[model samples]
Target: MITNETKENYNQCQNVNCSTTFVSHETVARYIIKPQLINVLIPNG
Candidate 1:
């Protein structure tokens, strides 16, 4: 692990044949709509 935080994480591959690094993000929704509301807006036949 290179860096770790509440919202984001940074990591690197640990292989002799690989040199890959990446960052991952954590997120939360500010607001959510119910499934029923989604169905009302976008009906499925």
Candidate 2:
């Protein structure tokens, strides 16, 4: 259920375990958006 609007929320993963913070549209798009789109891609996964 990821959307361009929902993408605005939780802008940071804050991977404290890894001591990293992904904070950018492109970064989020790659790590988050692509995965969701994969499942929703009409052809199916």
Q: Number of clashing residue pairs in every model? A: 0, 0
**TM-score of candidate 2 against the unseen true structure:** 0.17
Give the top-scoring candidate (TM-score): 1
TM-score of each: 0.39, 0.17
Which digits, one per residue and each the tens of the lDDT, describe model 2 over residues 1-45?
255534333355557776555544322334443444345457756
Q: Candidate 2: misplaced stretches above 4 Å?
A: 1-16, 26-45
Model 1, position 17: C-alpha lDDT score: 89
RMSD of each: 8.7, 10.3
Residue 17 accuracy (lDDT) in model 2 = 75
**Local distance difference test scores for all models:** 0.65, 0.45
What's the lDDT for residue 15 in model 1?
Answer: 95
